[model samples]
Target: MLKNIFMLFISQGVNYLVPLILVPYLVRTLGAESYGEFNLALSIILYGCLFIDFGFNLYTTGEISKTENKEKIRHLYTVTIASKFLIFFPVALIIIFTVNNVSQFDNIKSVCYILIIQMLSSVISTVWLYQGLEKIRIYSLVNVVVKLLMLPMIFTLVRDTNDINILATIQSVSFLLSALLLITIAKRYDIYLVKINFSDIRSILSSASHIFTGTISVSLYTMSTPIILGLVNTAFEVGQFSATDKIRGAFISIFLILSNVIYPRINKLKVDNEFLAFRFIKKITMIQFFLGLTFATAIYYSAPYIVINYLGSEFQESIDLLRLMSPMVILVPLSVILSNYVLLTWNYKKYYLCVPLITCIFHFSYIIPLSHYYGAIGSGIGILITEFISFSLLLIFSLKSGMLRKIYES
Candidate 1:
């Protein structure tokens, strides 16, 4: 577990650094307005990736941890890959139609289509297979290699606003290469590509459908922020919001990566002795709380400095927005633990879905109305509000379900 954590930490470091490096470069090269559009496009593209993934990362990983049967694993791989491929077509059509319909998508419209190729690459990547198997080295290596390879190309190819398509192309090609490499390495697992059928795909989907239900709500509240911000405000406002949000996001990803390490182990332990899982959760939650609080404090206090000196004055308005998002440092871990670790893992899909569903309703209500008066700050506040709401909902649901008691009293 420690080794898995360490490797994933390194993997996450590479992931974080690439975006950190890109944000500044992309912002400067594209200009604030164009960078804002880029972030919006990326956010929407992330939804594409998420849908194609369909919660397979969690569901399939858990399934893999439970079995060593190569044929079963192969079946899992085949169905998931087939499901992803089948879904991609309709999603692509929807995106194309929507992009063409919205004139705001005009400048970078082609880039949007190009970005879908990256999503397809993500579908083929077998990182989740290694993660569940506790063989994270290959997953980490592939990510680092891809990041390293993309670094120079990004610097060389993306020179101006007009080069948005070129930038998208570079990212897509790098992603495809990485995915293919992962698939090659995954051949060792005896993952069969030929034994897939429609029923197999349907079975895989049926099993993970609950996860997808919760994920859709969770993903909506997450991905809707940029969309709403773009709709209610100017590209400039979106740019500032995106810049600050990226910083807070990068920090929160640390806790998320920790979850990736623990999730599989706990699920495995859950098969034999749930007391172990509960104790594990408690110890880790304490660590997460401290790390989250420390991060929130550092970022809240340093928000102004980060926006002005570090990101330059083009992002000056991001200062207060960053401060508004500081609460996520603690809220993110709490919500993640409560919602994912307890709610979804326990198959309590109703309560799991409720937290995000209600949170999304509250967020949309606050964000949509408030953005009219308050802009990006309004959106940030809405996020903080949702965090509080989700934490409260998860706590209440977990207590009623007895998962909370197991964790605390065990």
Candidate 2:
């Protein structure tokens, strides 16, 4: 598990740093307007990626971890892949129609279109397979190497605002290449692709539908932030929010990497011994909570310095937004542990779905007003509010479910 954590950190470092390094460059070269446009397009593409994923990362990982049969694993992989492909058509159409028709997307329609390749790449990823198998070194290596390779190309090709399309194209191509490489490496694991009928695809999709809903609702509150900010505020505010959000994202990514490392292992342990799994979750949760609090303090205190050093004086507005949203570093990981590791893994899917469903509703209710009145700062506060609501709901549900009580009593 520690080894997996280390490998993920290495890979995720590349994932986070590319953006961390490029954001200032992109912001400086492309100007706030174009950079904001790029972020808006990227946010829209991320929604497509999330839909294409359809919670396969969690659902399939749990399934694969619990089984030792190579054939079963292969069939699971095939069905999940096929389901994504099947879902892709409708999602693609919705994305295309929305991009072409929506007045907000008019400025970046071409960029959005080119970024559809990222959604396709998400469909092709085999990272979940290696993660489930607890042999993620290859996946991590491939991701790190491919993402690193894209840095030079981006630096070389992206020189002006008009090159925004070229930037999107380059990013999509790198993602596609990484996915294909992962698929090829996955075949070597003996989990090669197999032919599956429509029923097989439907079965996996049906099985994972609850998880899909939770993921989508989660995305609604998380991914929709910048989108809402873009629509309600100006491009410069969006750029500021995006920059600060990326900094907060850097903090959030650490906890998520830990969650990813532990998720399958917890599922595997739960299959053998539920109490043991609960204990594992308990220990990890405390550790994550501590780390999260420490991060929150660091971000809260260091926001001004970070913003000035990383994003420059032009983005000074992002300082307060970064500080305001800093607590999300704590809320998000704890919520993940409670929701994914505790509720969903234990088949408390109703509670799992309810947490995000309710929070997303709360999110949409206030996000518009907040963005409208206070712009980036308001959006930041709105996100923090929703995350707190999610964390509160998850904690309440987890405690009331009696599992945590049982762990204590045992």
- Screening candidate 1 with a backbone cut-off below 3 angstroms (N, C-alpha, C), the clashing residue pairs are none
Model 2, position 147, has a per-residue lDDT of 88
lDDT tens digits, residues 208-274, model 2?
8999999999999889888998888887888888888888998898888766779999998888888
How does each model score on lDDT? 0.83, 0.89
TM-score of each: 0.97, 0.98
User: How badly does each model clash, as a count of residue pairs?
Assistant: 0, 0
**Clash count (model 1, backbone only):** 0
- Relative to the unseen true structure, what is the C-alpha lDDT of residue 8 in candidate 1, on a scale of 0 to 100? 82
- Per-residue accuracy of model 1 over 331-365 as CA lDDT, tens digit each: 98888898878887777888987777787777777
